[model samples]
Target: MLMLRRTKNFLNAHGVEYEKEHVNPLMVPERVYVLKFGKRDGEFLNRFIVEHSYTWTGRDKINKITLRLHGQKHPREFANEAKLLQYLEKHADRYVKKQGNKKAGKNS
Candidate 1:
């Protein structure tokens, strides 16, 4: 919950309003987070749904997956956006960080 607060605060400080919505159990998500940043292809701002999972299993074995974005049309991995959780905890850096990069930042 602390990480979520900081995330929302960080975005809110940047003049961006972090959005929170009640997730549906049908989506099979335990939680959800979202934010809107500046505009795009049609002069409209793009809002991204930030989805993350800690662990999952298939065939009774651990599965590896990280944060992803579900575009209105399809789901895709936006590697860069992982940095949005830079200041976030919850052992997120392990999956979010790229190889040999000290941390998730613009330079990273």
Candidate 2:
């Protein structure tokens, strides 16, 4: 599966809401993007970002997929999987409401 799809599936399975931002390299003309999750999933998002490496070769290859978990402290430590899940669980209601709003907006 493509990276974006995999990432989206991962978030959906965990009941997290996310937005994707695509960044194209200017010099190499390659496709690269950053997937950013909302503050509700900040902890898990941090872990995902930390575990992945971001590097580019000759600007031609899409080097890295940057995962930005919103509302995290600048330069925060990587959160553990269990902690991330706990955070998500705690905020489940808020996430559900947000998702509902998103769906409603799309319909309109």
Note each model's CA RMSD in angstroms: 11.5, 10.6
Q: What's model 1's TM-score?
A: 0.34
Q: Model 1, poorest ten-residue lDDT window?
A: 58-67
Task: List the global CA lDDT of all models.
Answer: 0.41, 0.46
User: Compared with the true structure, what per-residue lDDT tens digits does model 2 show for residues 1-108?
Assistant: 144454466578756656555555566645555555544434324323323223454222333333233454553332343444455556556443344344445557
lDDT of model 1, residue 59: 21
List candidate 1 segments past 4 Å from native: 1-3, 27-29, 37-44, 52-82, 85-108
For model 1, residues 32-84, the per-residue Cα lDDT tens digits are 44554443443324444545444455222212213333234553344433454
Superposition TM-score, candidate 2 onto the true structure = 0.38
Best by lDDT: 2
Candidate 2: where is the Cα deviation over 4 Å?
A: 40-62, 67-108
Q: What is the number of residue pairs that collide in model 1?
A: 0
